[model samples]
Target: MRFLYLLRRPPYSGSLAAEAIDSILVAGVFDQRVSVLFKDDGVLQLLKDQQGQLLGHRSVNKMLAALPEYEIEELFVCARSLAERALSLDQLSLPVQVLDEVGQQTLIAAQNVVMND
Candidate 1:
């Protein structure tokens, strides 16, 4: 079945991003069709130069890049959200579809949708 995972928080804040990534991995293991939408501050998690090593933490970028290996390729990022934060697509490493307000609505109208806190 087709599924969408909506992420709405930044990674460094807490485990929300990590948990979402884990869920996506599990979904992949089960052969479920999964797509991700990084909205709000969640878009920050995809910034290309994440340096968690200095903070003694693992980087989510590595995991983010692994999505394709897990067959989760349909990645989307909220254009307004990214722009509000003054972030550009060049700052992110993942292959993400830039979605405007209209696209976001169409995305949510999919077969299944999941939101991350």
Candidate 2:
């Protein structure tokens, strides 16, 4: 089955992002096709050089960076979101496909299930 996770929150802002990570890992473990799209403030989750020490929590980036090893290689980020935040693709900790608004809609429509965070 295909699972699409739509992340719309900033990283480490309580448990939302962490929960999404758990969902991704669990889904991937079960041999399901999984993909994640970072939108709005969620794009901040991909920023490189996140320091967990400063936040007194483990780096969410650590888990996010492990996606490929977990067989979750399809990472997407919104182009407009990044642009609005004055961020560029090269700033991300890991490589990700840039999706425009229409691309995002198409991806979500094709998913068997979409869980939002």
Candidate 3:
């Protein structure tokens, strides 16, 4: 089944981001068609220069980079969400397709859109 996982919160606040990443990994193991969408503060989860380890927290960037190896390549980031956070596409490690509103609507039209807030 095709699954779209929408991550809308920052990674540091709780385990939502971690759980999503874990889900993606497990899905990959099963050869599932999984796509991840980074929206709102979730864009921070993909920032290149994260200092989570300095705070004794595990960085999700490494997981972001490893997504492709797991065949989870349909990565996307909401353009408005990035702009709202004052972040640009250049800041993310993953090759993300910028999803504008129309694109978002189309993406969630038939597939199962799972939102993690």
Candidate 4:
């Protein structure tokens, strides 16, 4: 099955982001095709040089880096979101396909299931 995971919240804001990552990893184990899209403050989850993190939490950057290993290579981010935050694609922790607003809509339309966090 094709699953699109839309991560729209900032990482480590409680358990949502971590749960989403866990879901993606589990989906891969079941041989499901999974793609992740970062939107809104979720794009902040990709910023480089993430430091001074809160105590008792796993590294968001580390989990992001491990996505490809789980065979979840179709990572995407909203171009407008980055621009609004005054960030460029190069500033992201990992490389991803950048989609404008319309492109994001098309992607959502194409997904069989969409999970927003």
Name the runs in model 4 displaced over 4 angstroms. Answer: 52-54
- Ten-residue segment with the worst summed lDDT in candidate 1? 108-117
The C-alpha lDDT values of all candidates are 0.86, 0.91, 0.82, 0.86
**Model 1 TM-score on a 0 to 1 scale:** 0.93
- Worst ten in a row by lDDT for model 3: 108-117
**Candidate 4, after superposition: displacement of residue 101 in Å?**
1.3
Off by over 4 Å in 3: 113-117
RMSD each, Å: 1.2, 0.8, 1.4, 1.4
- Model 3 — TM-score against the truth? 0.91
Candidate 4 to truth, TM: 0.92
| Clashing pairs in model 3, backbone N/Cα/C closer than 3 A | none
Q: Mind sharing the TM-score for model 2?
A: 0.96
Which sections of candidate 1 miss by over 4 Å? none
Candidate 4 lDDT (Cα, 0 to 1):
0.86
lDDT of 3 by residue, 41-109 (tens): 888999997776876677888777889998889998899999888888888877899999889888877
In angstroms, the error of model 1 at 71 is 0.8
Candidate 1 backbone collisions, by pair: none
Q: Write the per-residue lDDT of candidate 1 for residues 1-117, one digit (tens) a residue.
A: 877888888877766677788888988898988899999988988998898677665787877888999989999999999999999888898889999999988988874756565
